[model samples]
Target: MTGRRGPTLLSLGLNRARDTVTAQTPVTDLDEQTARDELARLAKVLGGANAAYHTSDDPVISDADYDALKRRNSEIEAQFPGLKRKDSPSEQVGATPSEGFSKVTHAVPMLSLANAFDDTDVVEFDGRIRKYLGLDGAAALSYTAEPKIDGLSLSLRYEKGELVQAATRGDGTVGENVTANARTIHNVPQSLNGAPDVLEVRGEVYMSHPDFEALNARQAEAGQKQFANPRNAAAGSLRQLDATITRARPLEFFAYAWGALSEPLAETQMGAIERLNALGFQTNPLTIICDSPEAMVAHYRDIEQQRASLGYDIDGVVYKVNDLGLQGRLGFRSTTPRWAIAHKFPAELAWTRLDSIDIQVGRTGALSPVARLAPVTVGGVVVSNATLHNEDYIAGRDNKGDEIREGKDIRVGDWVQVYRAGDVIPKVADVDLSKRSKDAPVFEMPHSCPQCGSDAVREPGDAVRRCTGGLICPAQAVEKLKHFVSRSAFDIDGLGAKQVEQFYADGWIAEPADIFELRAKYGSGVQQLKNREGWGDKSASNLFDAIDDRRNIPLNRVIFALGIRHVGDAAANLLALHYATWDAFSAAMRTAQEGNPAWNDLLSIDGVGAVMATSLATTFNQAAEIASIDRLVAHLDIQTAARPDTAGSPVAGKTVVFTGTLEKMTRAEAKARAEALGAKVSGSVSAKTDILVAGPGAGSKAKKAVELGIETLDEDAWLELIAPL
Candidate 1:
């Protein structure tokens, strides 16, 4: 990997003797096996880098280089999200706290920020925030854009205007208490004025450029190793065990955020930061209100231009929703706020030669084409594979009728521009047509599934082309099995995606029903799951118990676990309410072919439409599908679906169909009244129909009701029966 041409990925210290077989393999172009291999290496590298920067006051890589490593790791995790290792670097926040400090557990966690590396990401961040708050695209949103300090995050607690505690933002939950070291810093006020009884000020402890250079000069004269950067210097100075030594170091603090407050700070983000500044804390002076992405980006650019002269290091600009009320509504995801994002400057981009194009099947059977590139460095990370969203993305057109890549189609053997940013997968931003060979191949999409040889279909108006093989395809089968035990489905403990995939590969389980018979089939056999690698006796026992716990599943879980098309959790719940039980729903679906009366009954369910009804009918009516359903049902007791509390309503859970004109009540009025009592009002009478109301001029419907042996009532009788409710 490192001859006269110079090293690429192997230069990142990932070089290995065994890795020489395919030393050119790009980090981004990964199979599960290789991803695991690369993730382990990255974890070790990043952990060491964090320690060297945070604890030792030394660094192996520049801040830009370290960020790129994290970004590359994030990209790999995104590609194989389900295969995330336990020791993945993305899950960690910072290095371990230095010894000799008392640990403090924060009541409210100090979370991290998700990053947006380019203008497109900034626009997307705004859109995602609006979507979460149920705001329209045209809605006016105010945001506060501030410089993101490249320093250690610290939390300072004040009790009735008196400084009480100080700690680092360690792992977002707990940290080492550095109250003594914090008091030594001049910027950290020992007492506050006009502040709440309890307030926790969260900010960054940093050193300015002049102070950093001065401190390094002093260290050099004292015959001590100089610090690498201001951030490292500030972190090391603040965490020192000796208070006098920390007091001698020149460090500063800027209040940007808070953790806990007894009283209201302000209505908006800008107001709160201003209040903090008024309360004798130094907040970043460049903080400004930006009402739109254009304003935010303008401010970001201004900060980037002035970055060199700011005297402190700043990696990016942080934009947060201004209104506290809106922030509460937007809330948090995992460890980051959805309402806020760190909009960094555009990452490094480089030209790489296109190696080839490969089509891969996703969990949903969508055949996504990937561009395999010749290994090249982009933004300090090795670039190998870039996502070609679909045939159109490869062909340079978006679904919205806009031209991307300047209306150019990417061809094999062409030099392409690869762009990588924080967490986003590296993409072919543009193609270099001048470098394209005259005979470069134009990639064509396959008509059949690559895995199962089934028809691959691109539905009308859909950007993605999907395989139609259903459970027959191994990819679809494994994904469906994974979905069945997903958190929203059966939620069988100890059974995750990895386990499901392994079992499927080993032929231990092929479908949902096969999971229940594991004990009977392999309990005493020579081939047993407990005997497999990465499995133990206790793990096998726990898995079996977990499976047994879900034997009697709720109807909604059952419906969701089936992985039916167009029937999500809400639709499944609606079907569960209307049918009440699996047997009832299955019988109705078996009888519902195309336009049968049972099909109409299924369609009449609230939220159930033609698309969902047709898909459900077709799925349940298939002989193979029904047989599989029957086998799964045989091992357990099927719990009846619970309806919303309607015990007081006399007509609750009743199926009523009205026919002909009513004398007392209008047909619409009668239907509304029955539905209000939780009754399923149908347009046609079927075997499932409980009662049919007949009136004057009733003809075919009345005779059909009688033929079906459904109880019939007159319009007056129907009015009287419903009147009691």
Candidate 2:
């Protein structure tokens, strides 16, 4: 049958016979037509699975099977081009790159919910809803009160019952295409069980409590950095470049709203939620139907009381108008909805003793005082310390000149109110005078640095004191080294926090210069590194290679890695663009300290304030610090500055913004290629923008560019402009 028919039969998971009508016919025999039919069926099933994996956070098929089936379908399509279908899995890009998260004009604008701060606000919301619907005060409205999840907002698009696109809520109008990462989430459905032909569902992508704990445990065990909170963890995980990595992490999703849809359900909003639930999507169970704003406020109180008990993280309760018709009438603001409001829960608070006041030296030598509190759990994490901010914050009193917390001062043995602001860091909200002991000593700012005992003084008009000892300060040195090798900083592979600490403890490294000299001192000549526990020949070699690979670093990255005070990535990039070379930057810093106008100009750069400028100047002014930097420079090879291509380059060094749909390549791809060729890509078109790459359906960005008189190019014209260069 194989020779008589063709490869189609053989490729359809069937055994073939050499001769045509044989006595022993294959039991799994499939004719040409049957094979084609079966192949299409299999493709559809696999595609559905792929969509499930991508659209819904949960996956039903194994990775091995998915890969094999995809490969088989590819082979079939290659052999039978005419048989190829429009929705072939082979044609789809498996994952979207995270770089350059361009704006996606939402089919239906994603509006934010109005916020209700208190019970009064809730009552007002209820009155407005009833007034709009022409309902009597006595008319009760059913409401579904649910915990408002604190996580990343996403929109999933489905076409013909299959998931097509998933996007982040970037600036409302645009968002990063995180479809691949979103697929890894188990709760996000790849294909609806009984989905509509076209549907767009909005959901909150979160990391559950148990999953968050396990993730943090793994992070701790692996010695990798841990997330500050679950919301941050979920956001960071969903934005990962590799979707498979996202799949490995614990992520959850709950459908809360809808965008563009082809059909309508019952008149009420609750009916639409029920429909979503029937479609196998996970919706928050806490949702309640309330008839009036008074009932909504009651529901908010109930949810707030159960906030700690709920396994998932929720910042507040979302109250939406039940009737769809009324909702349409209510309308919306620029970025938020008018028909709904978010009722926030009261802040979590705890009382603890102020054991002591200690100063911590940061990487920038800023001495920040911390209130050492008795161990207490304010939100979830244990609170042992709270930021005192500065001397003024500690000394200032109420308008009456009495102590703020009932005449109590921040001192040892004084009870302090520890409050978790937005579930982040615990801060000393107030001091309790009634509980303050007679022996409670008044706290005073330290005269010397806690780490190095260098003269610590508060500068004029500055609230916080700073350590003058730059490189000699132990705390600052350790933090600076850690920051230099952090993932977002230099990204020096194999040189994580543990390794840095180990190297520092071993007396092998004291400054950044010592890192580049590790291979020279411990390479083939020494066996110490290999003999050390957890270190092997292969690991050592890999580490050495990773270290070597980072020798030629980008100027912007190098600037960031220097651990300069208040100099983040954006500031570093700005500095690199302005200076263009390390020597130029160094010279500028020195001249700035010497009162040069150019130095003052550097200080005048946006986001670079007088304090940051002073710190930068102070860092380079000392001869010892300069000598140490020179030594570090001697041990490392400075990367050559990339010269902007001036020959036939119309867009080189020009700032460009892209908007709408492109025909030749994806917006992400275009932006990446343009950046590689030495063009700056800005999210918004401003006066500094030189060119605007407008595609079909260009929106406000293009309009702004035109208004500013910036040159504009269409998709084809953009391709043409870059083609000559």
Candidate 3:
């Protein structure tokens, strides 16, 4: 989402469109309020767009534009499945038929196809289909590929081979009776000879580009309003109140699917499409049978290459299971069919002015640069921001310290290309040096933290420049507070990132310790949390109780909640396993501050090294931090970390180090498996190490382990050792 500090290009455009979205989209995942607000706003915008296009045949935005909004709505719904609204756009095909025509409820609901954003998604779709069908590698499977037409979804009902009713796919189940207008279209046959007794052919009603241009020419000559695009033109022409008017317009139809069939049309999807074409209906001629994922992607590319020349619009390529039997087995999931997908073309890119750059601080205190772009449409998504990566990137350097952009640099007022893909943040791809503006200044890294006024420094060999204010920085403090209740941390109920931010903003809480003290400070006074906005007696009480419940937490969680630099979940767990209690860990850290015997013991604990030990010691040395921790510790009983169950596991209670690449699995997978079986996976080899799994590329770690007389095993030997388990 575009930030609200100033008017982003998106906000400016939204204002120009006069559309009032309930709330701006949150930067990342949608919380409860953000989801509700965005959903309501999208519903209003899309519902309005739908009515305008379906009822009047005059759409305000392009087909691609509508798809983007609908796509955003779908994404938000997915992130918060529990917050899905009853009037969700995902459950609908189009707007309700206007009052001009009577409504028709179909026996079978017309559904929409799910979308695939890229090649990986297409491969995943194929793999998912195979997995669901209990199929494996080299198993024979096929799909029918065709252009996903950009037009209104209409269902043409027939009775005993006679055209009886024609309707729009309104909300899937019920639709407007457009029989009079539909009968005027040339491709729609009044009577069929070899069709099902109760056949309902469903497809799109579209107008070719030439026909649309000619229609617009005529409209201009007659002083009538011209449509925005062909889909709108065709939809408006077919949905005319007067049959004579619809008959005069050049509206075309392509029958690709059917509903409410009295009998099976064919055994396969392609055969059914052929049957539809035989019965006096137009079907896309480019439809092909694909036998593999590679073939499907190749077809998608082929169709995308020919999309513009085809005249009418096509947003992407649709893939359907060739075998109707397999399609049945695949079945449906909520709003879309499981056996089919619309692999959309990559989002279109647009050139926009690079307005300025903004700096954002993260939880780790790293200052990241962001490019503020003039709002522009890239694949229907309005992009106003892009990642600048770092100071070097803005100066036209790549990650490998090589120069890109032909030595050209991005600056304010330069025309830059922005690319947007599915749910991906738009990024500046290239700059038009020819359009670069004068007096543009180069971005410089800040010397002091913007959030806490602390000195910011770039550590040796590190690309990111970070603030050294630790938890004293407001930005770092809030982030640490949020992390203290993260999913992998304490995970207190009703205390999410949004709530943490709220608590920080309203002065109700600051540090992790402040959370436990909330009930004591505001339980009964006018400042009671229950009296706060968005809070009630039961909810606030539940929140306080939730806080109390987490008073007895695991040692690993307490260590992680401290947000000590370089101390990740794995490291915290290892420290907990080594010390077994908070008091022991604290005592060791206090002693380790002076580089005593406890310090060497700390460094010798598998992953714990000089850097992490120093950080742990520094944390306890800080008066402010120590006081905060002491207050937090006084409120609760901390449990010992859960050790891996060692029973029946051969690697149990062993210290192991994996050196070099393992042929059987990835390094991450191997380490995870080793830990699961009660083995302490270390990064470095030491005297305490029990064994070393050295692969072909083993380096210094293996040599050190051998020098220390630790047992060593090759990847094959390691696999053989665990083969029985």
TM-score of each: 0.46, 0.50, 0.51
Worst 10 residues of 2 by lDDT: 15-24
Q: In model 3, which runs have C-alpha deviations exceeding 4 angstroms?
A: 1-355, 373-385, 398-400, 404-408, 413-429, 432-435, 438-440, 468-472, 525-527, 593-596, 645-648, 653-676, 680-725
- Candidate 3 lDDT over 435-492, as tens digits, reads 5657777668788888888888888767778988876788988888888999889899
Question: What TM-score does prediction 2 earn?
Answer: 0.50
lDDT of each: 0.78, 0.70, 0.78
Error of 2 at 77 (Å): 37
Residues 1-725, model 1: lDDT tens digits: 00001123333442231122123344444568656655666677667666555545454553445565677677778988887778776777666666668888888988878888789888999899888888898899999999988778999999999999999976678788999999999989999999999999999998887788789899998989786557768888998889899999999999999989998899999999999999999999899999889899999988865654576767679999999999999898876888899886544454667789988876568889998986543432345688888998888899986899889999888778777643247788888787688888787889899899999999998788899887789988888889889998889998999999998998988989999988788864323767887778788788888888999888888888888878897687778778999889888988886677898898777668898887788888788778888888888777897665666876788899886546466567788788777887887778888999975335566778899998899877877776767
Residue 433, candidate 1: how far off, in angstroms? 31
lDDT per residue (tens digit) for residues 1-725 in model 2: 00011123333222211111111222234345533653565556555553334333233343323444554565556656667777676654322223445446678866556556678888887777778778778886655567788777889999888888898775355567888888888888888766777898998888876788789889999999886557657777897777887999999889988988887745788888989899888998888887666677778776754554577667678888787877888787655677888776543555667788888888878889888876553443446788877765676454334565544457777777787654456787776676677776667888899889999987775556889887888888888888889976778877898988888878777888778888787656236677777888888778878877887777788788888777887788777767788888888887686357966788766557777787678768878778877877675666656656666677777888886545477667898778767788887889999888875335567667879899998878888888876
Off by over 4 Å in 1: 1-29, 346-725
How much does each candidate deviate from the true structure in C-alpha RMSD?
Answer: 21.5, 18.4, 17.5
RMSD of 2: 18.4
